[model samples]
Target: MKQSPATPLPSPKERRRLREAGSLTQAQVAERVGVTREMVRAWESGRTNPRGRKREVYAKLLGTLAEEEEPRRPEVTEPQETLVEPAPPAPPLTPAQAFDALYAFCAPALVRQAYLLTGRRELARESVERAFQLAWQRWPEVAVDRDPAGWVRATAYEYALSPWHRFRPRYRHPEAPPADASDRALMAVLLRLPTPQRRTLVLYDGVGLDLPETAAETEASTPAAAGRLMNAREAIAARLPELSDPAELHRRLTELAATERLRAAKPPVVRTGSERRARFWTRAAIAFTVALIGTTALTVRTAPTHYEPPIAPGAEIQGVPERVAQGPLSEAEVDLREKLRGEMTSGPVRLTPLSR
Candidate 1:
């Protein structure tokens, strides 16, 4: 047999209204539909819709419920067709425009947050600018992010709290304390807290993010985040008793951030700077690669094709003849030789005597 046609359901709100009108709980609907209550709730809230066999079942159930709940009206004979004007579409923003908008909206706040983290006006400005610069470099990823501000904020915070900044000459010494003594004390206390605790407190108490959100942004577990918040608050309260209240603490943080006139650079300037930095690095990389290739080519051209063994050093020969040495004759031996030559008694003397 051919399957029956699938029933159509109304909008999410209408479905909810029909179910409520029929005095049925979500649990009851879920039980009848052979799914979980959360799934039914998701359908009613439009987070998700049922699909496949479940979709047909859900649609049929909701349709029957809608028919039962909706009142029937008497038929009227008139032209039922109505001309409805369509809504105009909004103009799309250019990538540059969208990036500027995001920068303008998030930059100042991020700068303040960085100042709170680092307590250095110049460093704070640098952090926010750097974060925005990175965002511009990765604009495609940043643009599509669900929380672009949070992304920038996290980046700024990371840069601000970097330990390597302490090694920089300019950042070696601390910035001048806030003029107000109370502000000075609060800043000292905040600076004393560990980086993670301070960040957690700022995100939770100052920025008003929920615990889970703070934890996620800080890359900490929820319990760890909570502990950090608790510890930071305790430390702050210990030093400054009046800021024991989280709200009051938040207010003080706001005031502390506002104490300095930390202004962000213009969006266009930031964008241009980011582009310039990217181009410079790209050129540097290309130059490096070309140099490496040239060096390799030169080495290959000059390299010896075959291995040559080194010549061995000379050695002394053993068996060579040495000169025989003579001793000097004494005076008596010389006289004897002269007398024997003069006597010439032998027969051969006559032949040799004239030669002597």
Candidate 2:
């Protein structure tokens, strides 16, 4: 049977109901259609007829509305295959390459979460950067872990909790920091809690990390980690009045993530020669300081020298000359000297004393 062309269109009340149910508001539809709320209101009320751009926007909105209004039909099942085809082999990844991949993938979400946790742009940036740097260093060990993002979040939280973050001079600027509403709201609540509690809450609830993974990242036992998360949640829940609506908060977070992704995708700026030279000198200085420290440590740890006892004095030595008789000698002494001389001239010398 041939289906007749779809009816002209549903009424504005019907369209509004669909839009509301599908998580869209009149303001959102207006922004998408580039129209004013009053115009949308009028169109919905059937007081003002929409045409051209307005008509086009209405048509698009109605179509979207209709699609959302349709019931979720059950998915059709296909015949079972006797044998499943194996997935294509993945290319092997080097540690550095894998680190870069994971960093790039998680950076947006991490940054957004950091901003939400700290409410400070600079802190968020620093936290994210340090987390990625640490991740890079331990990539070989961490890559095999089940939740790398959780690890990154935990690292970032530690970075946020570092003394520098708490003690650093605050920036005083005319313009307020630009963060989404959700980030602002979340950060306000997070900063009120102690650092450890805040970190636990952000990792588990904000970033969706499991308790064991959170514990591993935070260096806490699983039960302790769970307690922290629960405590954080309760604290936030107590201060719920300060936060915006949950739905609005979610939307703001989504927007922040999108913005970060767009910003990260842009080409990085190239450093000038002077900048490169400065960085090289800084690295060289660090290396020299480390070397000097190592040398000093080695010198301090060496054992001191001590003297040993000298060899005992001997009564007689084989290699020494015997005292010789002086002046004119008796016949016996002369005979002994002659014998000694004869012995010395031969292999070895032997002396005999004469009786008085």
Candidate 3:
């Protein structure tokens, strides 16, 4: 039998928007449509289109979503009963309130995520706290961010995975593993993976983010992220054959993370700490600048204004005769001295006689 033409669908963005508006995850939609989550992502991204039975099902799902999303007008006949007053809008949230709400909501999950990344309960909590502290310090930027939770998550992940942390005295020793043998083995395998691959796996499998989103957060190309994820899964599956399946792997990861009882500092504490840190740094910078200015001024005041030639050091005269003690004069030296004296007297004797 000849089939009818395929149903016309909306743009890729519209398709994604409809699914999101319906509060459906890509995995959920993929399950309903009998396709892989990657396929769903491709369809939504306009990279490829679904065909045959899946196309019809996807189109129908979108139609239903569109219908549900449309606003229905109340019947005109129902308005004649009683007058009603509209409720007043709630007050806008203060910066502190907004920050607190964000922290409270994201901190718990972030702590768990950090634990999975670092396998250290204390460091996990600390990473989340530090990330939130930084976020609070840059509240204006974070508050206006498209996804504040994502921003904080990236920061926490970066901190947790930093190689520098290994040098810290407290973190130099590994934390104790989970109580269960399976959990211990799983964590050991996870810690063996390279940082990039491990982060990709956690963001994609553990956190349930789509491929592109995972890549974006990990700061890798989509293909690179996919490769890392594949390598990571293979590595995990090699160590624990039971977790070979992606679903099972995800479940195991969740269970592994759940084993840790991580908690974050309260929002007030985080905010106050952040403020204190900022103030300390600011004061230090001001003091440094003031000292620098004073030193410069003092130097200018004490510096010499005119150039003066330096005096040369004294030196002995070349070819000068050395003095010797007087001894008995030689015969020739004595005779010459006497002859010169007598000659002078004889020349003057003729002139002196007439004057006397």
Each candidate structure's TM-score, on Cα atoms with residue i matched to residue i, is 0.66, 0.45, 0.71
For model 1, residues 1-356, the per-residue Cα lDDT tens digits are 99776556678888898899889998899998998665676678554567778988888888888778678898989977989999999899999999999888788888888888989999999999989999999999999987788889999899899999989999999889999999999999999999999999888777767677789999999999999999999999898999998868988999999888789999999999999999999999999999999999999999999999999999989998998899899999999999888874755533444553
Error of 2 at 227 (Å): 3.1
lDDT of 3 by residue, 333-355 (tens): 99999989878654654444555
Local distance difference test, each candidate: 0.88, 0.65, 0.90
Number of the top-ranking candidate, with lDDT as the measure: 3
Error of 3 at 316 (Å): 14
Answer with 2 or 3, whichever has the higher lDDT: 3
User: Candidate 2 — what's its lDDT?
Assistant: 0.65
Checking candidate 3 for backbone clashes, the offending pairs are none
Candidate number that wins on TM-score, 1 or 2: 1
Q: Count backbone overlaps in model 2.
A: 0
Q: After aligning candidate 1 to the native by TM-score, how far in Å is the CA of 151 from where it should be?
A: 1.2
Task: Identify the leading candidate in terms of TM-score.
Answer: 3
